[model samples]
Target: MPSLWHSIPALLLLPASISAVTLDCKHIRVDKQSFDLSALGGPKTVHQLQYLQPSISNTTFTIDICQSLKRTKGVPKSDECAGGTRVCGIERIYNQADDSSTTERVIPIAGEFSTSHGRAMDPEVTRLKDSASNSDSELEGLRVELHGGKWPETSGGSLQKAIIEFQCARDVTGNEGFEDAAEGSMLDIKSYGNLTRRAGEDAQEDDDNDDDEDGPPELPDLDKGKSLQFVSYKPDSDGVGVLRLNWKTKYACEGAYDEPPSGGGSNKTAHWGFFTWFLIVTFMLAATYIIFGSWLNYNRYGARGWDLVPHGDAIRDIPYVVKEWTGGVVDKLKGSGGSRGGYSAV
Candidate 1:
């Protein structure tokens, strides 16, 4: 009979069934266009938005496009969702009688939260039709779908999902904390219906809200915002939760990532610096002089050992020469021999 240890090797050899999910915000490619969102993902940065319904419930959505959100303090890695988590939602419901609040659930809306194998399905990228295009023939926005988040137990057992829409904004940054005129960032709430309904309505509302010819729409403030902002969260008939967000950044504009060519004959130029050229020239000159001198010493004088090297005597006496020079400098600094008396030297 085989021992249990013998069976462990076979299990170890088995291939993993899970697939890896890649979230490269710096290089999000959609058709002919590419987006770089490295600006939003700063060191120790988490873009968060809060929603509160007075005396009922409050919710907060936290997201990071380039990396996993920082792990919660004092919480074990296993207990809190950290690795492979791009977007998370935490909802707290308040008691009607005493105004006491309890956390309803913490949902990892977008990302793979597996402790063992770090893998997930590819995020779905699609072209979105919005007011920016104005015509149905041209789609002006981008949509990214990320799912496979660990579902809360309250739901039968379905993975959490999130959809992010990239809309063009004139401003580079949307954070009110960073910008003076900017009001707020996001709006997180329950979805009244489908995503299309909200997007279509909001576009028309923006036009109506535009007070000045050159100024932005007069929209209400939510909180200090980022390029990515929460829109709504709705569960399907099967109780699977889906969250939506709107991203407004210059990167969403057409041809934002149309980079110039990087090959030869381009207008761009690259040249060695003065210091680099100096080092190269000095090294070549020294090498050539040594080679020529060494050959001359070998062929003309039949030199051997250290004699074959150019300036071999000086090179070999470097240590002794330096020692004598250092002693002389020290003696000079010491002022002729210690002092005949303590006050003899000034």
Candidate 2:
């Protein structure tokens, strides 16, 4: 005879399945990370990364990806980062030197990257192959269309699931200290080439033209409250591959952000500022009335000025009383006052 609440946990533990299509994507954090490199004799280039914050429309990320390449087989290094693709999008990368020096740059956003291979002047990566050896490589930009919602507008966004596809590739080096150790390194790369849906409208839509349903829905805007699932990953074993990433970038504005405590950092006495000013003004006004009233009565009413005023009778006799008291003191001091018998200075 357990209550309904007691059965809730049991039901939740029961094996359940969902048919919703979930997108898988490599979770590229919004921070600086180790830059990716290509095979041996790869161009000496710099790569950039950046993300479009919900508040910003454009951003810039500058980096100096520095690695010293050595001459192999008595051959001078010819091209730097010559045969590789540098993926830059929707993020920023920071390369900070130990001297407290930092380089910042913005990466490309959605649909903005160079798939072309081995051009000397790739916008994403700067090539200084011909420059002096040990010269720092500067990554100027990885420009692309930014996707994100605005603050306050995108706040409390709804959670959504997206099928993201990404390819993870890293440079693997065998010789720890060869002439071109970093470049000659070979690592088995994973690629996510095939994208599968739940066989719904997203999978059936073939025409990229004006159709009710396009291929897969665009990525959800990057938000703190949104959910992203990388649908799959494919690795490339031999040839170099592009590390493409799709994220949840179109979140519905429905989830609630952790609002600061309703009355946090607020002082209960904040209104005291106004209250203090009010008291000062009231006191000043009262003082003013008192001072001005005395002046007016003296000037306008002459001898009868204080006659009608509060406690005016006692105040009016102040001069006469002071004079009488003064004379009495003088007479007593002289030992001539009435009923004073002692005249000797004892």
Candidate 3:
């Protein structure tokens, strides 16, 4: 026959039937050409730029700035730009060349810009014409730089600060373009908009109110033990998702204190009651034994007297003799009486 311990395996198996819920995080995209930088328009001149590119999920990305050789001061170093001066400025670059050089030199374009304030500014694609003649091949590397400056001041101001953005994508030309070939090759663009230090301040204030609205952590009841169990599940035929956890009582003090008594009474009360009952029963038994013993002795031997006497003959049966000198004196007295009668006869 199976014992009670055998049923525990089945009891433990009961909680395994519970199902577990799955959670996943995805990359969401936003559609907005330029983030507003008017919030940053103040006494301090603010230069803003935005760009877009592909980003690995939950990772920090690096943005690069590339200057076109057409805009440089020498012969064309790269095919994207013609022979010109290569000028890379943190912010603004002045174009002082003549009309011939200006026609030969391609204009320096602005890259994407981002800041810690979570705002971004992307390049305006409509401002420039597409010069890529090849349609089928991929555009290996493209760079853009952003310059901020005022009309009058030449240098040394907030305009001096500029952000550059870079991105990599397939050349959109018609020859070998992924779209033309019917392959689902994706073109990912990462964007960094202009950000101000004061961005998200209102959101932070709302966050403070939310913090105050949130309640305190719930306290577990110390009285009852909670029974909980965890189970694993397979979401797909390949058995990809699996989880494990312990099944046990969830009493707040189970691990902290001694086990409570089975009875409802407090420990001290139970102990005192047990001792009292024990003493009462012992006293009763002792009293009963004393009374029963006295009754038994009275019934077995009543009050009685005992007598003792001697068993021997009387002393008068023994014989005795007188001394010989007393007997001679009696004989002399009789002879003297006879001698007196003879003297009277003479």
- The list of candidate 1 runs beyond 4 A from truth reads 1-21, 42-54, 75-82, 94-100, 114-121, 129-139, 153-155, 174-221, 224-227, 259-346
1 or 2, which is superior by TM-score?
A: 1
lDDT of 1 by residue, 266-296 (tens): 3221122335547756765765666677668
Writing each residue's lDDT as its tens digit, candidate 3 over 94-161 gives 12122111112222222212222122223222101122535312322211223321111223312211
**TM value for model 3:** 0.13
State how far residue 36 of model 2 sits from its true place (Å). 26
Q: Which candidate is the best by lDDT?
A: 1
TM agreement with the true structure for every prediction:
0.49, 0.15, 0.13
Candidate lDDT scores, in order, read 0.57, 0.27, 0.25
Poorest 10 consecutive residues by lDDT, candidate 2: 187-196
Candidate 2 C-alpha lDDT tens digits along 278-302: 8866765654554455546656765
Candidate 2 Cα misplacement greater than 4 A, ranges: 3-5, 9-346
Clashes of each: 2, 58, 35
